[model samples]
Target: MVAQLMRSELPVLIEHFHLPTLPIDPDDVAFILCADNGKATHLVSYDNHLLELDDRYQFRICRTVEFLQDPRVSQAR
Candidate 1:
């Protein structure tokens, strides 16, 4: 899967990003920043802190299952 992703055009490799100070966990900030910088429609994760920030960010935060079940995600495939 890693090799496939590396060769695919679907991924955007973020080389430089300005880290923002958020109220959430330090380790999770990178994930949020990546999603935000990538202009993602959905931020998928099982972390409770991220899930709780669902309506706060530019992107929609959801669980892995919820993301998989989203109609938009399926339509994008």
Candidate 2:
């Protein structure tokens, strides 16, 4: 599954994120940092730390189901 994901077109790899990022959990910061640094359109997660931050940054946070249900999401894909 991981290999397949690496081959997928939706996800992109980022080299690094500049400092002075969010103040949330250091462990979970990567996810937010990735979205922030990449200027992502959407962030999908089951974690509350990230979900609660829907409007806090450039991206919109939602679950897998919500993402799939959105017409805009399909168009983006």
Candidate 3:
């Protein structure tokens, strides 16, 4: 995956964020946006910033407490 990510030109964008480079590849912002558009899975986030993306991404803006009590999460176990 590191090789693939390197080839995808993601390292440059990651560097722009001033984040330290790591061995493992992190998911790209564009990929996350595409995933939301495709309705691939639930986008779980407690951050207020995620609310701004809700309209565009069709993501569920859940609180930390609500996420913890969601039955689907428990069922996966």
Candidate 4:
């Protein structure tokens, strides 16, 4: 699956950011975090470690349920 994905035009997940500092080794955490930071948007995740990055990154971190319902969330179009 990874090889097939790499061969496509879609961005490979791990290439999204520098992952050397990740705490739990889950690529999803880094992927979502970097995307939000790059876009200046909120990060919605179930991971507790990720939720703790709000103060450091100037972005909101919320559970997926809360993020989807927040009035501030705007689709990127």
TM-score of each: 0.66, 0.62, 0.35, 0.45
> Which candidate tops lDDT?
1
Residues 14-47 of candidate 3 have per-residue lDDT tens digits of: 4443222221334445444555556643556654
**Model 4: residues with Cα > 4 Å off, grouped in runs:** 1-29, 74-77
| Ranking, TM-score, top scorer first | 1, 2, 4, 3
Give the range of the ten consecutive residues with the poorest summed lDDT in model 1: 14-23
In model 4, state the lDDT of residue 14.
47
Tens-digit lDDT string for candidate 2 (1-77) = 77887778566555465644453655677887777778877789888877867766767789999989878889977
Alpha-carbon shift of residue 25 in model 3 (angstroms): 17
Best by TM-score: 1
lDDT of 1: 0.79
Candidate 1 lDDT, tens digit per residue, 1-77?
Answer: 87888788585554544643363676787888889889999998888988888888777899888888989999999
The per-model lDDT (C-alpha) reads: 0.79, 0.74, 0.51, 0.62
TM-score of 1: 0.66
Worst 10 contiguous positions by lDDT, candidate 3: 16-25
Count of clashing residue pairs in every prediction: 0, 0, 0, 0
Model 3 alpha-carbon drift over 4 Å, by segment: 1-10, 14-31, 67-77
How much lDDT does candidate 4 score? Answer: 0.62
